[model samples]
Target: MRSIVLLASACVVTTSSSVAAAQNPAAIEHHLRYAVRVDGQPDVAMDLLERMRSYHVPGVSIAVIDHDRVVFAKGYGVAAFGGSKSVDSTTLFLAGSISKPVFASGFLRLAEERKISLDADINTLLKSWHLPESKFTEREKVTPRRLLTHSAGLTVWGFPGYALDSAVPSVPQLLDGTPPANTAAVRNDTFPGARWLYSGGGITILQLATTDITGEDFPTLMRRLVLQPAGMMRSTYENPLPMSRRGEAASGHEQIDTPVPGGFHVYPEMAAAGLWTTPSDLARWAIALAHSYRGERGGVLSPAMARQMVSKQMHQQPPYGEGYWGLGVAVIGDGDSLSFSHGGRDEGFVADFFMRPASGRGLVIMMNGVAGGLMGEIERAFAEEYGFGAPPRMTRTIVAKSASELGAYVGRYVGAAGKDTVRFDVSVAPDSKTLQVYNSAGRR
Candidate 1:
């Protein structure tokens, strides 16, 4: 890793044109043949590269953590659609909402040092710009704990970000939803601590609070208290990355065919959707938290604080069915079965990372494409290959049928009732044992 100076974009160490054999040869072989079962078929395994091509995902970076170590880290595809620069372990990608968890870590470190309190009324700790008084705040105090848990009832689910040459608002301006800011002001609509509502606005408030209490900017405080201590040296909260380091950052793309005109969008909401980082750097942050949870301090968070950080802070379950928000990360299951995870999307970028704190096994994935659905499929492949848990349950079962039976279903079925024309193709797969249904993308 190279020392990056404080500039618009932090300069990262440039490496060779390529990376080591896609991280590991054996793993790649396994992944290619055992990719997640698409549709209802069991033997349908699409290689990662093939999936990228089909989904129009241009670049991806992945790192696997097992037994307290980053066992593998690699990149795939070109950083830009028409360019040859390969995405390697150090290539930067937007952390998106993953910044929330990282930001929570930094805020908790402040709490650990007695610089801030988790349960303190957030408005009392602010001076530069206070959270506007609302009927909601009068009923229940909006504390750091509630804010971290996203129960602060703040508005703005997320930020869309600005183009590289577009106007970028300051944190205060963003909070107030003032001129040039696209979203509404960050204020509570419901009672505090009522339920879970994903609010990037709330996280931005914490960023402001941290800045006010420490008399330091968000990025500087994050560096001193979180990134430096956790050894995430390659990551930064800086937005509109400095010009010098832009070459090392992966270019964001709409899909495989369309890259953003400026390579990537500039996010002014640094706390909620900023943080430029790599998968390897994020794995280090996850591993550090895992280590801390085991009573071994690996970074800024204390053992007790780390446990509470990932513990069940709010009981409101996410609509996804199996997860609930912790202080920052989403915890799946309960007790020893708990695993912490979070997913992020910003413009043309998508990312996700997870870890089983007790077992110290996890993976981090980042891609510079809008094909976020590809991330979940890739995760399914990795999970199955690594034996982290059972393979994803198939939605429907595949039953064998004779040639005559299969032929009966093969044909173009046209809808007669709809004003708009609708058609579907149902055909038997080459193997004869399964059927292939052409989806909206026309892929079987």
Candidate 2:
């Protein structure tokens, strides 16, 4: 909403402050209650917030829209690690795989124009390329729809990317399981139109196909079809820090030994892993999703296609159902009150988007700087708050070890003094076992 630039430390602290400021009525503190119907709302909302915060998500940006209105939008924690910048509605964040469903929406738009066919195997559209050979399966039938829905079964989470000074694979090399891929070839992992598997590589191939077929760069395509139409102005498909434009984005951090700025280095794959923007901007995208479900022309996608996008594509795991996979969005359920969502995470970033078509409620959360996998709990909280489903029960496993073994978990936290860290050391004697926490700041 505003043209603003910030340094790392200040960016992290202040961004969240603006979103959670006292003036904001729909702050993240009560995000769980935004459109959720529960027996006791206020108390439950407070507890959910506590649990989310308790999980060590340093920063979180959440947006809740109901019935075409923005019911809640708030930011939490620091956007830039060791910086004063806070999470706010205006802060830009990497939305990881969330961009996939959005990209799928673009493909659906082209399909509507009869420019492409979802059922058509993608081999025909590769500009100067074709699917690589696979000893495991036939590749001729691999379709764009299957790739978008992850049914085409391409392997690899992504390129795994080479850094600024490192050698990265070219598009074909990456797809062909060449030197950089170092794994399965670009050939179909599963027969086309079969089961679902989450493959960032599949999306990457689709990018090549989409660009070749449409004659546009990925950025131009996304902006023209999805960003502008959906009103996501503050976003872009550009992933790495644009040369000469480095300061425009919020930096990320990691907390393994100490809080380090720009966590895990930069990743090179922009299509499957790039795209950055604010929750406020994404909120509009969520609203567009809400509109699409309600028979409104929210943007690039038709209403029918929009519904198809969020439906389950494949059964990813047991108890998760044969999750609907239309286009890119992984639809988890079709309950009268809720539809499941797909979330994305990268080295230094994490994001989640939930659309409740049944109730006209949509939510998205983004965060920079992570402690560990605990960041996912917030998404679970959002679902539970809305009565979408019950949170899974976790069982902790305790192991015994020697004192020397337990002593290895020691570390000093270089972050702000108050931030707690999680570290455990294990040690034991032949007669019995012992556990010692050399350094642990955060409460578990």
Candidate 3:
């Protein structure tokens, strides 16, 4: 399994581009009104509404921040298909893994206040369910710092969440992977601090530790330490979001354009994937981070801590070769061009945010359907409008090649690394100048 995973890892490179400063609302709106285009395909352009319709996304909300302030925020489409409620700046959508960075900010505040130490063994702070003792902990103990950076060597990359009507697991039950909990037990598989691997299970441990330390529920603690301070009034870590806010919440839609059972799955893994927020609220949180990074007062995190939050903690290994992991976000670029970002995907929601703290610029995008590709198109539109350079353009430059030149590359190739072997065949196209590659399945 490991070798197969390694072979698959060698097959792709992930690239992420940053967004620039914001412009006037009218100009930005005008830019969005025009057709969004793919980087290399000039003919693939669709107007924003048309694109949304084609992608089956029922609703989308966007917020742009420039010079440390939200310059534009709006929503398009209905909160749920066939519903009369329209999405607006205040409409809430599940934030999925974006919850990590937000939760990290609150967790750091605990560290700042001297309530918890980032480097202390997590067992010392956790009173609810202890991280089970294992061989992986012999030398390096799992600590808050390691968990924040996803270097704790823990298992469970993410959760599938519970159906709205299903029984929800307690934090301890979830961690132990007992009945009612849908994931495997959260335990160490590799030596802690050896490498970077994303583990939402690790963040769940933090959630338990935080609640145990503060003697407060996760939602309350986050509101007091992070959301309220950061002016994210519309955000909440509550699972099965309260009924009072239901009218303002967008129903999650599957990729097929149908709403999820009972509107959406309920995520009890609140610290990792259960946040509900508006793009505007997320923008506010991003702005607060920028302020703290600049050493300004009245921010949730201290300037020093905020700096570390966005600094590179560890380089991500292959398959995630695009960037480094900060405390809770992905760090890309460097120095003046540096940016911190995170993307999230739940059962029926997709959200993403990018912020260039050095320049006080960023954008938050939230949608109610599983339209991952559409999110990229929207992001590129924002990039072009705000002048954040487009993602590396993929251009196909045709060069005249002799038949012999193409023939030289036409052959069957087999490569083995350890016990795993990869086999593929290459053949020239009918045009003779083009090449086609096929795997063992004979499909290109």
TM-score of each: 0.82, 0.73, 0.84
Question: Model 2, which residues run further than 4 Å from truth?
Answer: 1-57, 135-140, 179-184, 243-245, 257-265, 318-322, 338-340, 371-386, 389-444
The deviation in Å at residue 248 for candidate 1 is: 0.8
lDDT of each: 0.76, 0.59, 0.81
> What are the C-alpha RMSDs, in order, of all predicted structures?
9.9, 10.4, 6.2
Worst-scoring 10-residue span by lDDT in model 1: 7-16
Which 10 consecutive residues of model 3 have the lowest summed lDDT?
Answer: 5-14
Which candidate gets the maximum lDDT versus the true structure?
3
- Count backbone overlaps in model 1: 5
Ranking by TM-score: 3, 1, 2
Between candidates 1 and 2, the one scoring higher on lDDT is 1
The lDDT, on a scale of 0 to 1, for candidate 2 is 0.59
lDDT of 3 by residue, 234-298 (tens): 88998889988878799998745578878889999999999999999999999899889989875
Output the TM-score of candidate 3: 0.84
Clashes of each: 5, 38, 0
Q: Could you give candidate 2's per-residue lDDT for residues 113-179 as a string of tens digits?
A: 7667777867777885787656534544777878887777566754344444556666677677677
